[model samples]
Target: MSASHTHGDCCDHQDRHQFSLRKALIPIAVSALLFVIGLLFNKALNNTPYSVGEYAVLIPAYLISGWSVLITAGRNILRGRIFDENFLMAIATLGAIAIHELPEAVAVMLFFQIGELFQDYSVGRSRRSIKALLEVRPDTANLKLGDQVREVDPKSINIGDLILIRPGEKVPLDGEILSGQSQVDTSALTGESVPRTVVTGETVLSGMINQSGVLTVRVTKPFAESSISRILELVENASSKKANTEKFITRFARYYTPVVVVLSLAVAILPPLLIAGATQAEWTYRALVLLVISCPCGLVISIPLGYFGGVGGAAKRGILVKGSVFLDALAQVKTVVFDKTGTLTQGNFRVTDVISENGFTQSQLLALAAQVESQSNHPVAQSIRQAHGKSVHKSGVQEYEEIAGHGIIARIEERTVLAGNDRLLHRESIPHDVCIVEGTVTHLAVDGEYTGRIVIEDELKEDAIAAIQALHLQGIQTVMLTGDNQAVADRIAHTLGLDQYRAELLPEGKVAALEEILDRASHTQGKVAFVGDGINDAPVIARADVGMAMGGLGSDAAIETADVVIMTDAPSKVAEAIAIAQRTLQIVWQNIILAMTVKAIFIGLGAVGVATLWEAVFADVGVALLAIFNAGRILR
Candidate 1:
């Protein structure tokens, strides 16, 4: 058994023998004792017993499994905190024993303990998954001392301390690589599936695994202040920030448990003492029946279990649902607003075609374009330089000047070159033909003559169309928002078959669009969700009812602000997130209805004379067991 699993009197479930074989032994021992005693009594005397001894054998089993609860309840009663679950279980079981219902009392406690065990097992499994993501603070790091490697705690490893990372080892601290290159798996931090390649001069984060090559890293951040550690802390404390449903259930149980206890006491005592004129034993038996019916086991436990299961389940699938409130919000999301660049399309720019004019070769036009744009750092400039297929030499370029948002002007071998849109050519009074091409076009001009134009565009994401269709199937309204011009936006939107499209929006414009949708959705039965992947989109992400981040290539600000994070860059995960949320909500409602229905039936039966103490005990524990099992179904 793992040492972490050992707690108080609870058997360590990690132990193979205790969890499996020992549990199997409990029923066998009970059966043996009961059967042997009954046979011996039958053989010795002439009286044929009704197998009553079989029920008596259950006492040892119940005490073995649930004695901790009984002790805890007794301790609470001695103090003043007597209205808890432990107290409820103890009272109900003791009442059943007083009514001469040994089997029922033992069965109820046994079944309840079994449910508790199951919860512990499920919780342990989830804890394992959570721990897998949590990069624990490393106690020691391999710091280079002279020519040899020495072991030192991560805290002791200061800035510029060279830490050697061997194969299959986690990076001890965040720093820039001093030497070597390797594929670092960052699935723990971003929940992404692929490994990221990192080389010298590039930054590497702590808790990432060095897959194959060895690396000598320098420690930049302190051990206590690492990003992975901070994120783990956030995840651990996430449960404390409960949803409205979680708070409601907790409050509901606190009042509901005490009320049921009082009502059960009244049902047991009032009628039998005044109206029936029954004997003390007969009245006490009825009171015990009342206690059994008023257990409240189902409602008290299942609601929180349902939500916990939902959150943990979503986490397993690489979706970081912050809390139950966000999960609930996502289930009812109708309008999904998407940012055009990184959210719906691959934001990377690629050169598509080069349309040359005035008898200029593609190479000559591209070289002139690259020389002028060498002084510029625009995305289009980068795409043009990358597609030129030759290294650019800035020695020939003289007097380079940037024209703000328009373009760039430079002198290459005394030839005036302008590499920008038609706006720059028009502003410079340079004559240019209207050479129309699809997507984004970067015009090139040399000596006031139109040389060529490079077509640079952002491609649509592979699953963009399918993702929108999936949302439509779920009756959700999909909307696209972009800062791109109307013509370009319309081309991408129409290709994706989106329900609605809005183009030419600034950062504030996008926020206004989200607010309008949210206002409209407030009157309806759904929430407004914004999906974006830029720093400027953080305000809109925070303002929306539910914010989804496209991870992998997503910005740190966007991922940090969003409620749900899709680990992959694929937009199709948006639909998957909604589907999972809807499923979780359905499971929660099902558990609530089932628990309430069973409680109502048993409570009504216990109030009258129709049900016995044994039947009431079965109703309480059986319903609780069923509801817990139902909650666990979500994990599967």
Candidate 2:
């Protein structure tokens, strides 16, 4: 079948699995009742010629329970794909019937069907859990048109249109609140429990619930491009990118089933001829038991299910892992590198200190610097203007010139004012006593005389220190890279207790530095991960072993290039992501070892004639259910 058609069939099967528990029970109930009746009849007959009556009831019971398996096996045989679980089941039960072991044949098929029922129910429950975790898509929007409000599909609402959100309603689209105040619940998007108070001009994303007070919001993005839609799409497509372990299991199953089938055929024939004491009938029965026990249903289903559960669990914590492959990579990460601004720090600059010289008062220096730097859009310039707290009139400013890579030089009311870094001071032949400042310093020069400096700093994020400490506790190294000077980098690094810090590196230099970090981490050590949240960080984000992005306030380029997106924008989520990855891999391996060890022991027992057909059924289906339940534990 074509890929699309196969996917459609798979969906149909899942839909049936989701709702077919009651339907499935009916056939098994009837088959089980008939099997019981046939057993009683055979017991009462006790060597009479009326044994045909036992076959009469038991044949229908076996057919009812095993018909699907037999049909699927036959179809696969015609298509030259006979080595599968269904074929193993079909041949084992048919061999039992041929040897006149009617009760064992009926019992094997009946219990196998029961096992399949449990598997379906477990899988359906898992799918429902994941769906509930991510069911953030709003159904309708309350659109505000003129004086009237009308409900409409969220997809029909366009950007720039106003929408009214009542208390307890989910925000229909990404928008900014234009009026009113409310405490909005962001747990669905950020996995945070506390409701955030939002007011006029505050941006509200889709999937957030308004908790109190009616609000009017102007939509910023269409429904298709909203946060909820992107999250759904990311998770829905994650399974396509399988982990290496999942792929190995799949390849192993393909070769394993056929090899077991060949060995089973040899067991049926070679044993009777090679061993004089072995009877053909006894060896054939043992060969049938071996075939049933050797089915690889457990390993085939549980590995992928384990990874899927891991992804779902992480999503519940507001961490978006793009694929199982990334989760696997994250489990091996020994060092996490972070971009200083935005990722580790708040990226909001503020004037922290002001030093005066040449008899210039601190207030006077700040006012003059703010006025000169008014036209520049640099962050440091904005912080100075904010600290000054006054509007600059264009009439009082003239001859404004912005020196690239240096600072701003403007004529304020015909008095030359230079508000820039030390480079601008040196380039203009202005002398200053304080050449080196601890933090980001913007020097001021009034008419060839240096007038003190303003020290601005970016504060560390609230969770930065906690995040670093958590990584250290996990025995992973923490490092920071930034374009800021070494002094600022050292201060932030020391405050956070980071293992290493690289300062004053440009974007290209960050990539080169990352390459060195990767090289230093030998194959035996582990991979290196980079976390960043800027347009400049995209290249390094893409180059790292596992790239993480701060999605809440992160730039589009960085988010798009990242392998993992931390929606809460908390530095702490980085440690949580690694923890989740490691836990997921642990669960997956547990399932693998559990399935393999049980199968190996049971297969040996069946080949040596120590295990019956009933035990063989448990080996095939009982271990499968165990592994599936183990995989589902990740969701908990």
Candidate 3:
């Protein structure tokens, strides 16, 4: 089924109106004010012709818009380390004044101020997207004390408290349901779009909303231990983990600024002395112009802006990228491993068949099997109970034992009841078919009599095929790893067009599979991503180059380990994320190229005595404006 929800419309009416006003009126206000002042000052200085008050109006305009920036630039320079944006802008505007080009200097500063304002506006929009993703945290939770209901802070909720969840309400804590039935939207936590029907004895995650029925859940984790809180914390601080790209930019800017400064000085001094008849003053001025032109502001801003934009964009679409590193890593990911059940399929069990081997009827076999497995809290056992229509009375059972990693054995109505896998039946010397190639089958026996088998299948998600197809289109190889039987795993892998499959993998076995893929990636781009929607798959998710969690399902462990999260259960979003990252990186390079190109062209002209101080101001300021415009594409 298809679902839709609007995102990121949180701005208040006044805030939105202010944003629109700023966009429409701020520059115009500055420009019109400058023009009117120039006229008034020109009239006032009519007697003194040398006043040049027409040009002097720019000074007031510059002060209005560029004062804060100029002060910041001065402070940065005084600190003995001055390779920041403010330093570059200060040098460029000041150099224009050196040549006595008053109007040009004012225009240059004005344009720079406008560019900075645009940058601030765009970054603010990005922050809004981040905030929207974070707004999923609910304000309150329903706590049940005996028969009474109380509303309290979600943060104050503790483990084992019965939290009542209503239809259309987000499940406040990760817990097991004690009563009622409902379909939960786990898309936020699992990246699976289909809503899962959860009844009594089923686990529900925090942030998952109940679509139908009322559920009284026994919280298994505290509010602090809840998945939603951890996810919010991880995403909020993702910027702290510097990706290789960010580090490279940092190191590049650190050295590039110093080298450029030295080169500018060399250009100013060497040419006049070495070349005959070359003027020292002219050469010095040209070198300063070159320094003004090559500020590297575009390079610094664009690169980080690109990643930030990509992260914000993905977040808007319900994907939380922990850092720029994950965005970069995701682009380089050639191999992607997915956890089978919650990641690939819906992770809900449905009864496929009820086979009666001997002379027993189907209803008789189901009653005996459900009676034996009713005490266990396993998916397969739940499926058996579900088929039986209601919870069986425990009064009929005597000795009930749940074997780890196997099935349950119980004594019901003076008879030995075994409701488990074929191994449980074989151990009891019960005769039954050992295997099937279709769905997962659980064997049933009563007093050493082979009753029958019930086949169960975890259905694939509706968009599972589309999501896999989209991944393949992005040139990523998809693989499935699961602890399920080979036949079940293979069926899903085949249907989803998975490039590879590893079946019957234990939880540890999934980790081993990830290791093998990581080893192979070392020969290629040295990157791999693991996507899982389960708590058990957290280890493998962390082990991969980029850990991706389906946050819609609200798996706390998955959210903690994964570097990237899909807030909506849309597999196709994987492709969208990769596309956004690639696009962002491309835009960063484009801005860098555009800035350097204009600087190089104008600097060359300045050295040849063709580009004057006015031209120098234009090159410095105009290029900065262009780069800022290019960077805005990220918001789009």
Q: Which number leads on TM-score?
A: 2
Off by over 4 Å in 3: 1-28, 35-58, 78-80, 134-154, 157-228, 269-281, 355-378, 392-433, 444-452, 634-636
Against the true structure, candidate 2 has what lDDT?
A: 0.83
**How do the residues 1-636 of candidate 1 rate in per-residue lDDT, one tens digit apiece?**
101111221333333332454664565456445444533564333232643454445456557655867876676667766676666667877776666555566666666666556655655555555677664445568999879999887878788788999888887788888889999887776566789898987877777788989898887777755656645655666565556666666666667767877876776667666885656666566666666666655655566667677777766666667777887888999989998877788877888887888999988888878877776655667778788868889898898888753678888898888887666788899887775556777788878888778888898888999999999999999999877656778899889888888876766788888888888889997898888774557888899899887762224665468777665677888888888778878877887788778778866776666777668767776877787788777777
TM-score of each: 0.77, 0.85, 0.78
Q: List the lowest-lDDT window of 10 residues for candidate 1.
A: 1-10
User: Model 2 over residues 324-389: C-alpha lDDT tens digits?
Assistant: 999999999999999987788887889989999999999999888888887876667778989999
Error of 2 at 175 (Å): 1.7
Model 1 ranges off by over 4 Å: 1-63, 74-80, 98-100, 135-163, 173-207, 216-227, 351-437, 440-455, 552-554
lDDT per model vs. reference:
0.72, 0.83, 0.71
TM-score comparison, 2 vs 3, better candidate: 2
Relative to the unseen true structure, what is the C-alpha lDDT of residue 235 in candidate 1, on a scale of 0 to 100?
A: 60
